[model samples]
Target: MISLSLPSPAPPSFKPPNPNPKPHKPKTLKPSSSNPLHNRPIHHLDQAQLNKAISTLDLMSHHNSAADLLTYSLLLKSCIRFRNFELGKLLHKKLTNSGLELDSVLLNSLITLYSKSGDPVTASLVFEEMGERKRDLVSWSSLISCYANNDMEFEAIVKFIDMIELGFCPNEYSFCAVIKACSVKENVWIGKIILGFVIKSGFFDTDVCVGCALIDMFVNGGCDLESAKKVFDKMPERNAVTWTLMITRYMQMGQASDALELFLDMVVGGNAPDQFTFSGVISACAKLGMLSLGKQLHSQVIRLGLVSDVCVGCSLIDMYAKCMVDGTMVDSRRVFDGMSEHNVMSWTAIITGYVGTGGCDKEAIELFSEMICGQTIPNHFTFSAVLKACTNLSDLCLGEQVYTHAVKLGLASVNCVGNSLVSMYARCGWMENARKAFDILFEKNLVSYNAIVDGYAKNLDSDEAFKLYGQIEDTGFEVDIFTFASLLSGAASIGAIGVGTSKQLFKCLMK
Candidate 1:
């Protein structure tokens, strides 16, 4: 039984703040607009505003805005906190302009700032500027982490080898970075080598950091869930990150039920879920399409004060959208409307839900319009989803317009979007346009072939559909049962009794 406390009822705040949120807008020092640091106690400003203050001072050319130890440290912290590469770049330019010595501490912060912001190019530039002799262990670790965090696994692993060559022994953080890097590329041999390093460095048992990272590397990176479970089972301690990682990996592997089981275990064991934990389990519930379970989780989110978290809010939007029956995206829209921020993921999730669940495709398309007007860059998935909506609505003109948008965005060639366009054009009886889309695609998976062929077939183009059916074999795509069925149906529709009989016999032989 999943044991959870019935959360204390509170006056409706409507949207919940993330757990560990800033204390009701604490009385932090505000930087004056004229001069960011003027009349400001530097230490009293929150990291977020401190970053802004730093930017304002730089912009105003505050010549006296020196990068003192305290001021620079706060600036670096701000860069890390905000994931603001532009701010980090400004700070770096200011540091060089000030002719200040690039100390190890300052350089590490810059490297970390750039790395966390997914800019290893600049991070490496900072690392290369520092001589190896001047670099302490922290510098080496940060440089490796810069690559690892940015998904440059090869770069990170190569740097780790170089660090080992330089005789700088690996620490727990270094191991964590290396392990995380391994999780992306699934170089199990390299991961095995990293495990050896873990054992040799005497961190395998003692360092809980390595233990959790190893589990993540195995399950997430290597896709070896059994091994991850073993590592977690053997670990003497596990924190929220570890538990959250395990749950998320389970979801990634399509083991949402197992993820929910572990989430229950984590809660029952008194490990109160943080934002990520709730996000993962709620996502699992959404996948299961269990509306009641999803609602229960939403209540828990409200009670735990995580509704305002962008990630949590996004998950809630997706969950409510998926759990609701067709044409019932009201709850999902409410969450999106209430959110203080909306990233591409949040927008994509709701759009996908609306289209995929056969809900309001028109609403999905309208939302996409709003997203574009708001300047949220729509990726190929967004194009794919909205195109699907157009197909469902039989809005060929609108579908063609979205296809134009896809071309403008360089997403027209994306497999799913391309397939969707073919499907859309076909469903709307635009055979010539569908064939054009089918012809231009560089690669055609079974789904692609099915979409285009089905489109042509459904439109009563018996000759064109049969030609394409023959071309599927020439192109080395085995015709599936769906192919024969659709083709025979097309033949039947065109009153081609002979072709239908031949296809039926061929299908039976193939089967």
Candidate 2:
């Protein structure tokens, strides 16, 4: 048992202590035979062994083996590496008890630990507690990255502004983080400013990663695909990831042919496409229903030995499903049956393709049953897809089961899930159940309102449809073309027109 001189640990408050707290210097201890870190090899150990080596709090204490700043930093990194929140908090206690004023390095370690552990609020507090002068490049970069990685994009941009106000030069990572913040918020104006900074920093031409992230930012953030293309075209070097992202973005932009053409260009340019690239190109082909191109990509997948990849297999299923010949999915089902492994995405793709295509609602429902009976947990999309099967079958019992399953999975409030529930019940002539589901919805989108109103109209319940219409009008939900179409259809169906009546009189007057 070793007793080390330590300052009193601060109260659990996160408030910044006096910046100039009285410093207590500990007397250096001789390496003891009982000390853990000194007893074994430290440098050659991997992260797991390193973690296990320092598992005990007393083992790494300041008095035991004369631990220094470097030792504490290494241990903090372990906390982050292992996502060990309790150990991180213990280190903070040890840090305060040791009376070492937490500087940028140690503070950044704390920020990284908390951020990786999924506690961005504490990371922000640690950063804010730093004195004005103590906020260094590492400090700014760590805090900004903390916000960005944790999905606090707006706060990340705010911190970047603060970093710039302090006259600290940002590195390429800082630019990447701020640019990602812009992408998340779709703030092209701010993204352009950050791009200009990156160019000024000379990272635009030299850093490949910076260029790739910028491409996503421009297209996704700026909503300007041409700008993204310009950035991709001018890059001094492009990797597989860059090509894959561009191809995926092209598909997202409705340029499926362009995505395939780019894939060809990549092969011609001598870049071997990876799983992600193949997945994107295959998906593009599926969207365009280009069976010939899809087959060609499939052959390439076989040649590249990617036939076993779950992503490529799922893409193939989607492509085969969409590229129908003679109005049957014989080829798609065959391919799906051949798959040796199936994940949640795999199940989801096939279920959606089955139900969404014409006249396969029964098959989709069966696949969903299999998915439920298997190890794969059905996601919200799976529930949504299977619920459409219920709509087509008009099985009130089945729809209710799906609704119950959705609630059990905590997806009852998801817009797609909730909308599908209303659609299912309405299609089944179960208007009472539909109304109850609609009322319990946490939030309603236009699709939800449309489904319910259309359900009422299709069930010949025009009164209920009009009642919901009036409610939604005051509720501030903007109606779309589908809404009017359903409403007019309901109105026309609710009354016969022009049987030598008022509509006939109006027609005669017009003539």
Candidate 3:
């Protein structure tokens, strides 16, 4: 063995004063041979390769101080990208230990990370801490944005108000967030207030995003046509979304003719109709029963190759079904069957169309059953159409079966479904069932009571019918022509002369 020269320990007098002596200057980490970029910020690294690089760096004990701070922050960002909260927590600990947790950029990143990871509590905590530490606008905006995007609308609004109170002006992004929140809650009043703020902030004219949100808010809030038109007219610029909203607003207000006229103007204005615009035009045509105009629009749709669109196709089917012509129903069925994707609305349109034509009850029922067999769940509208068909046909068995199914689907409480049920039972000579349905109604409307009373009167049960009529009167329900007709008929059937003196009840019908 090589003789290891054991250097004698330093002489007793030569004391090693304070073995762990503090350096005059803080000892800075030198660049490691393993890492040439150790002194540089890790944010400069390719984010895609960050995970593997971080793992390798973890194994290496020697790392530059500044590089460690930067690398840990970048690594936290990567963890956020992957939504790996566990990894983020570990990196957070590292950042805290490295004295970078209070870093504004790092805290902002962490806030966004927690928000995106669906950890709003943590995001909120980090945000509060950031504010306590005097962070910048970006940090504030990040937390507000996270709250808004996370569907914490109330929280987001509070944060926005807080931000404003803090003398921090919101950017366009902040306005968009609050506007979207108002839109979601359908709080048009607040939305209008925000619009005023947006205008005062000078964000409305330059920001298309803010403009779009404003238009959406007005339209969705059931704003009047004049209000919507004013907004549209005043817009310095318009996009496809703006035109679509305007068309939709007209359609919703039952101004189908105006909607069609606007659509033509849009075409003349050289804005090509997108699928949504065509769908709106088609719906207007259907409502007007304007088969001729509807067909013209259909031609345009085909030319634009939008016939395959589910919404447009459904509208086309509806329009054709409403056509007064004999073979128009065939066209409706053709459109329906040809649809590559048939949702509940497709089936509903065809069934309602068949019911409207007065001899296709059997076909309507078959289509409804086929919808169920095709694994397409029937909605309230579907049941309503089928029930109407059953009422027209006086198919008691089918009507009751549909009622059972409606109950199974938890749609029996839907007003339309309940009305249809009462009508079907009354028309099918099941007065007891009709009364039961009427009784179960949470809201007893005049039409519903009238339905039951009229059923009894039609069946020549004047006494029972009169009792219901009295009940309706007791409830302060206004007697309409139908009510009077049913009452007069009931009294006349029973030879009660007093009912005839109730004022020219049948005069409207006579006229």
lDDT of each: 0.80, 0.78, 0.75
Evaluation by lDDT, superior candidate among 2 and 3: 2
Q: lDDT tens string, model 2, 1-511? A: 2111212222355644654366665433333345566533243233256445454435555445544565667667777777777877887877777766666788889988887877899988888898776778887888888888888888999999988987888887788878878885457788888888888888888887788878888777666789999989978788788889889999888999889888778777777688788899889989988888788778777766677788988898899889987677777777677788888988998998898787999989889889889968988888988888888887878888887988898988888898899888887878898888888888888888999999887777766776787776878887777876676676578673334334432432343
Query: Which ten-residue region of model 2 has the weakest summed lDDT?
Result: 1-10
Model 2, CA-based lDDT:
0.78
- Evaluated at residue 194, the lDDT of candidate 3 is 84
Q: Write the per-residue lDDT of candidate 3 for residues 1-511, one digit (tens) a residue.
A: 1111112222345534765555564343333334555533342335355555555554443544243555666677777877777767766765665544367878888888887878888888887776555667777777877877787877877888888897888898788777776665356678778888998999887887777667666766545567667767777676566777788888887899888777767666766667898899889988887877788778767766678898898889888877768754889888887888888878887888888888889999999989899999999988988999999988889898998999999999887888889998888888888889988987777888778888887777877886887787789877788887886786677666464534444442353
TM per candidate comes to 0.75, 0.80, 0.66
Candidate 1: C-alpha lDDT: 0.80
All candidates in order of lDDT, best leading: 1, 2, 3
Q: Pick the candidate with the highest TM-score.
A: 2
Worst 10 residues of 3 by lDDT: 1-10
What is the per-residue lDDT of model 1 for residues 1-511, given as tens digits with 9 covering 90 to 100?
3435532334457565765555676565344334445534353345446555675546435556444554666666776776777877887787788676778888888888888777899889889988976688898899888888887888889989999998889999999988888886456669878898788878987888889888878876678899888888777777788889889989999999999989888877777678898899889988888778778888888877788888888788888877787558889988888887888888998898788667578889888999999999998888899999999999988888989988998888889889998898888888888889988987788888888778877888767777777777787877788887777788778777685558654764575
The candidates, ranked best first by TM-score, are 2, 1, 3
Instruction: Report the lDDT of model 2 for residue 37.
Output: 65
